[model samples]
Target: MKNDPNFIAAYGNIPTFESLEEREKWLDTLDKIYTEVNDNFEKEMSKYFYPNGPVIAYGYTIDGVLKVAIEKGQKIDAAKENELYDLFSNYGQNIAVKDVPLIIVYEDLPTPTSRTSSWRPIIGGIKICTEKPDGIKQSTLGFSAQTSSGTKGYVVAGHTAPSIGDQIWQPTAGPSANKVGTVSKVGGHYADASWVPYSNVAAKIYDTDTDVLKDVKSHENAAIGDTVYKSGITTGRSYGSVTEIRTSYDNPLGTLYRQYVAGYNCDGGDSGAPVYVYVSGGVKIVGIHWGGVGTYNSGYSTSIFSPVSGVQSDLGVTPLTA
Candidate 1:
């Protein structure tokens, strides 16, 4: 894929550098370019789907083109989903149809609602809860951070709270599990995360590989194709690549911006899982895993993450470090 003419023209044309700083600087430029491409594609192509039809999602791909996810059984242009897939797969890239440039692809995917919160209350463990009538649901617990008042608090999905001050527990129903924290604040429209202050859990992540603890040092903005990891109760430890950065996804929860997509195989309970990449010495936090779509095992599925830097700024907290 790297050597493809279209891919190189759109994504691989960035300058190469030997120094990490220079490499990062170049990646930043590429990131901005991709973000603009994404924004332009959304503005122009979004009207082609949704409210008007069955298209559920429209976003940019790593190849710098548009991707549309339609609901199962949904049809477009009087063509069946499979037929449209073939047509796009075989000829979409060859067609230069817009000034913004687009190679539209289709996938059958849909969003699922959150259920009740229940699980083991490890720092990076699963935090499951219900959204009223949505039934049982789950999300990952991001590590704790120092609030503006110097208080410490862990983070979870805002949708899990449903209401502020809701008691968040380890196991949503079991007798042995205990209440770790309560929903202190929900970022509702700003982010898919919430602060849980006064939690008994420590500001440490359970390493699934070493079976040890790794303290989070700082937060970071993810770049496309970066290798990141996440730990959740459902999927345990998962390693995936940042597929898209600075993208927008609209769903029932709300439209989240400056978001990124990863190929990590995550489940429902994995929401809020801390996404990080190993740096020179310690780990740099990347994002908080949210919801995902498409078949989990399918190559096309992706898990959404809210940039950790954005989360911290919006919530007014700094990641707790060793």
Candidate 2:
């Protein structure tokens, strides 16, 4: 027997290579052929994925399993979301769970749009407007507090001020009586920040996903080319890098100095949104968004944010650490 009687009976057609290079060539061919076959299989399988939308990604696993990923905060219908599992036996594969496996993982991710609707929570990333729409001073609130003095409050655009003790309502289009808080303090030339004290406050912010809050740790200074992120009622949430730090911008209230300019843009109501960088556990507040030269145009434009450290000093408020 060349090797064994049983082996020769079923595998005698196995190829014999005269040289190592010949065998290597055949092995390379096998790898390409197998990969192409798998690619086609995946392409056809994608048709059955979540067609209704909101899917992050989906594909076939290495071991012939099907895997799908969705947003963490999305609501899933058991039967609808699990339709793939019901057909496990249809493709001549094993019907048991272990034989034809399916894996679904959830992640906390931002939605496509920013939140402009009225949020009862006094956290950041929601719309806030004057009680009477006095010229429609819509703006965004930054994170709340956990300071050394044990004082609690929220921050917004100083230009969005309707004067101290005046009412700030969520969703300027909603009910007139839906008051959230009042403007407590408006800073000087150092920072365009307004403090609005409220009980329902947290050191968190967001874009559309109001239920899932991202914690704000402390404060940091933005550097050129450093990554930045923000979510505002008008412009939504977008990612960009700090193109310039210690930049200056002139405003009607005063001249803001050492402001951070981001590559991303903002809109009219996006003022006072949090512009921060993602840190290890959560994020650090870099500044409070005001506006950029682009705000003078008719579309989304570059943004300016007053550095957080100076804003805290000017406003005389302690920032949240926890």
Candidate 3:
């Protein structure tokens, strides 16, 4: 009531009020008017905003109301459904963990060492050894393999099959491969998989460098909502939140199911990259990047990883030390 001088004078300037009792009376009147007006408004709005059926808005802090857009006519249990409805409705005003939906977006293409402080060069950019290289063009590919003796090995992605005796070289110190190890076995159609002696690299490799290894016992079992990081030869370093876990998908390589996360952008040479989780004191290796499910051009898609537990058991190696 901007137009009402009496209403303004009573509730406006404090010193202007004639007495404390008068001021209290004015405040009480104002509160009553506000409640009545709000109640009327809510009643009117309810008619237009009535929910169609069972669907509910998840993040609201007030009584969860079904939206009109939700599919109508579906039968829902009265007792159980009302409880679900109440949870959403009453808690709608409270901050909701699931309310915010974040999608992976490319702010920039990451360079080596951009995301992690411990990053270093892996194998000084792949140098083609010969002008006419044999056995599948020597393309870089990512791989995770375990030896018969139970040693876990990390592999670069490519169609070239490195035999059991093939000598592999990784940088002894850098953001990428800090330790050198040898190929013990190779598998997969394009020889995309290869095994290394876990014992040889165990002391040299940091747990932060591979997803298949973690030093923290608390994070040994990761779940949804945890934030994770990735280190690779290509695309260097990136970070993202876990969107899914224990999932499966099909690829040209084969049908596979593993833990998955979103937000990191990995490329061809990043196949053997390690996935890490950012924990309280340090980062832990949780999985290995197998392949990406989405296109590389847009770069906002889900990528799959093989868990570190499986990798550890297959390779028969102890976890990497932090």
C-alpha positional error of residue 296 in candidate 1 after TM-score superposition, expressed in Å:
4.3
Residue pairs in collision within model 2: none
Task: Give each model a TM-score.
Answer: 0.70, 0.58, 0.43
On TM-score, the candidate that comes out on top is 1
TM-score preference between candidates 1 and 3, better one: 1
What are the root-mean-square deviations of the candidates from the true structure over C-alphas? Answer: 7.3, 21.5, 18.3
By TM-score, the better pick of 2 and 3 is 2
Q: Candidate 1 lDDT, tens digit per residue, 1-322?
A: 4463222112112234677777555445444444444455445434545555555554455544434455556545534444433333333233432123333334444342231233233465455553345554555577667787778777776666646777665656334355676776777444677887863555567657445567666677777778788776667778878766533444545545567777877775677777887765557777777767565553224677778876776677677776
lDDT of each: 0.58, 0.58, 0.37
Given candidate 3, what's the lDDT at residue 113?
Answer: 17
The digit string of per-residue lDDT tens for model 2 on 1-322 reads 2363211111112235787666555434333332332344334433443334434333332223343445445655666455544443233132222343345555322111117655665677777776434354667777675445676777877766736886777767357556777877777556778777777676777744545567777787775557788878777777677654331323445434445556776776777788888787778888888775322455355566778876787677655655
| Model 1 C-alpha lDDT versus the unseen true structure | 0.58
Q: Where does the lowest 10-residue lDDT sum fall in candidate 2?
A: 5-14
TM value for model 3? 0.43
